[model samples]
Every structure is written in structure tokens, then in C-alpha cells.
Target: MSLFLIAGIALTGFLAAGLGTMVGLGGGVFVVPILAVVLGVELKAAIAASAVCVVLNSLRGSSVYLQRGLVNVKLAMVLQVSTAVAAIVGGLIVIFAPVQILKLLFAATLALTIGVMIARPNGGKRVKSGPDPYGLRASFDRPDDRGPAEYVPQHVRSGIGLSSVAGLTSGMLGIGGGAVQVPIMNTVMAVPLRAAVATSTFMVGITATVSALIYAGAGLVDVAVTVPAMAGIVVGAQMGGQLGSHVPVKMLRTLLIAVLLGLTIAMAADGLGFL
Candidate 1:
């Protein structure tokens, strides 16, 4: 039974990684829920594995985007420092919170994701997609064969705010928050939508790693859940990232909203002892 459960988890990890890479988001949203459902993992344990898998998926997904010249490293570096610091604090918060309460909060956030998705429309937007917005400009070639790319900022402070929020969310939840950060960069910060999406992939590892170590230290992580899940997630992210350039990113974003909402309700159920 353990072997069968392990295999099932491995498969789910693959699916999560694929979906995450396709959307330029980390796979934690996918990994965490599956661990809860199939593996009967406690929310805390699932969150730990989610953090680890997100880091692994980010390593694979971001590496590909970087190689293709889609990642904006300067932006990643600047945001990562603050995001990482915040993440450690955030992870500690999770450790101390009542497990039932944490579950409820996670559920609420899932509902928020749905609202964000429906409210925002992604298409043509011009914004700064950089970590250093204080007179720094970043230009890169598009990986998906769009063409050359360049971004100018209209709202730098807003971008920083969003990235900071991403950091907070990443720590509060066991997930990378590229979905939230990417859109804010594209829409509010006036970053080119495509560029923001591509570059957002790089932030996952930095954010997840910050919290994962704390979880590991707290003895909240279960290797039975983390090890195999991360292995599959890394491999799946690579494969999905290769396919990413082909799919419609907007569609994936829409799908991601529904998926996040469904998972949220399920998580709430788990909290209420329904699961």
C-alpha cells in the first residue's frame, strides 16, 4: 500500500509540475492539495512538501526560461532578498498558528484567487518587468519566438508592493506566488504581460527555499511525501516548460484560478474534518 501510495503521489507531482510550468507559476498549488487528498497528509506536512516541490519545480522551470533568455535575473535578485527574509518570518507564523485556523486561512485565500482571475483581463499591457525599478531598465529576447523585448516602468512602487505581497503570500501559504506577482507587474506596473509571465518563474525557488528550511527544521516535513514528490515535480516541470512556449498563457491562467478555488474548498473541508 505504501508503494502504491508513493507511485500515486509521484504521478500527481508530475501533473502539478506540468501545470505550473505551463502557467509560469510554481507547482505548489498543485502539489499541496494532492498530498492532502491522496496521501492523507496533514495540512502542515502537506505544506512542507509543497514548499519543497515548488523549489524543485522552480529550479527546473526557471532554468529553462533563463536559458531561453526569458528570465530577468536582475529583477529576480532584487526581489528575492526581501522576499526571502519575509518568507522565513512567514514560515514561522505557519508553525505557530493553530492547525485548524491555518487550514481555514488557506481556504479563504483559494477563494480570493478565483476572484482575482475573473476580475483581471490579460492581453496587451505595458509595464516595467524588473526587480530594480529605480532607474533600471531590462531588455531581453523572448523565448517563445515573439521577438525582442523591452519594458519601461510607469509605476515602480506598485511593482515592489506586489512582489513584496508575493513574498508574504509565499511564506503564509506553502506556495510560490508568481500568479499574483506576474499580473501585478504586467497590469499595474505596466510590465509587458509576456515578459512578466516569463520572468516570474525565477522567484519561486528563492521564496520557497526560505520557508522550506524552516519547515524542515521544525520537523514538519515528511520525506515520505517530499522526496518522491519533488523528484517527479522537477522532471515534470522541465517537460512542461518545454511545452510552455506553445500554449496560450492566458488560458492557463484562467484554468489556474478554478483549480486554486477547488483546492481551497477541499482544504477547508480537510480543516473541518470532512476529509
Candidate 2:
């Protein structure tokens, strides 16, 4: 690649990483769009690159969270398996899907993100919290040093079921599972929001790995486009994620939603050959 191209991709990765860090997200959301627009790559190619980027970014952040005792390892592992399986299936669908369909899905996902953010649902009844029946129970250290406590999920079955859906979304949409997982775990499973976010990052790497392997085996993985983008996103995301807090998150989120809507309409038009 030319020097300019290399720098451009690096910039993208940098932004992704920075922003991801700011928002406690893995930052994969920005990768595909950046690759598509900047490198002029096809959607599938961009998605694949974004998937691999997520894997690496997760690994990077996971170790830190693990050290801090933030990751709920056992809980994350169980979810990972379900999420990975779902993602593998989703990734294949993306490979064959029309751009218009993918765009609509992206827009819809962003809309979902916005809705959840606005709701910030915290009040809910825990169906079963004291006695864990689902064998899929665990614990972790909270950031505030509130003393270590074991977590018995009230929505154990539903959590797994939603994970399956999140996995599918991740694969098809080239997103980290956290976008959906974090909210559900917090609102339904009663997992604390920060812990949920951290654990979701832990699981995202696994989901991305599964789908990436499948894509690689199918000869659809394009390192030429992916590597530079990853380099840029990983670096940029950390900063962006940190910056996420300083700004009004709702405003930023709404802006992102608007972009998502425009992209969706554009893609729909493209599919209808109206653009």
C-alpha cells in the first residue's frame, strides 16, 4: 500500500481504539464503515477486517480487565460458546447478503442502540436470584470495591438465548456482541452495568475469532485491506472511548444514529438502483 493509504488505515484504527476505550466498547463498530469508505472495499471485505480487529482489540482489553478482576470469566465463557456459534452462522449470511439488506440491518442496530441508551433500564424484578438453577452462574470484582459477590442470574435461560441472537447480529453486522449483551445482562440478568460491559468485551474476542476462522477458511479474508484498518482502529478506539464520556453521550449517540439512518436509506436506494 502507498504511504498515504497506510496512514489513513492507521488513523481509522486509532480512532476506533480511542473511542472504544472512551465508551467501554470494543470499537469494532467503526471499523467496517471506515474500511468501506476509505479503502473502497466491499462490505463483506470490510466486515471481515472489522471482525479480526475486534478479536485483537478484545484480547488487548481483556487482559487488563482480567488483571483488575473485572471480567466474570465463568459467565463470559458460557456466553462465548453460544455467541461464537451464532456469529459463525451470521458471518456466512453477511458474505452472501445484498448491500441494501446489510445497510438496513446496520441502521436498525444503531436505532436499537439509541433506544436502549435512552431507556437505561434499571428497574426490574428478578425472577430468580437467590438460588441458581441454571448451572451457568458466577461472580466478579466490582470496580467500587463493594466487596466480591457471586451473581445468580435471574434470567439465565433468556441471557443465553439473547446471546445467541447477539452472536448472529455480530456476525451479520460486523459488530461486537457487547452492543446487545451489555444491556440485556444489566437489565435482565441483573448484572451491574460496568461489569456487564467488561464481560461483554471478554466474550467478543471469542465470537469474532469463530467467525473470522470461518471467513478465512472460505478464502474470504483479505489481509491486505484488514491489517491497515486494524492498526488504525486499535489505536484510535482507546482515545475515542475515553472521549466518549467527556462529550454528552446522548448527543453523540444521536449523531451516530442519524448517520446510521442515512446509510440505511442510501443502501436501500442503491439496492433499488435509485441512487
Tens digit of per-residue lDDT, candidate 1, span 3-82: 88888778878888888778655677677776775567677888988888777767766776777776667766765777
lDDT of 2 by residue, 151-259 (tens): 6656777888889988998888777868788887888788766667778888888888888887787777788778887777765765675566688766666665565
Among these predictions, the greatest lDDT belongs to 1
Worst 10 residues of 2 by lDDT: 123-132
Model 2, 18: alpha-carbon shift in Å? 2.3
* lDDT of candidates 1 onward, in order: 0.75, 0.72
lDDT of 1 at 241: 71
Best by TM-score: 2
What is the C-alpha local distance difference test score of candidate 2? 0.72
What value does the lDDT take at residue 46 in candidate 1? 81
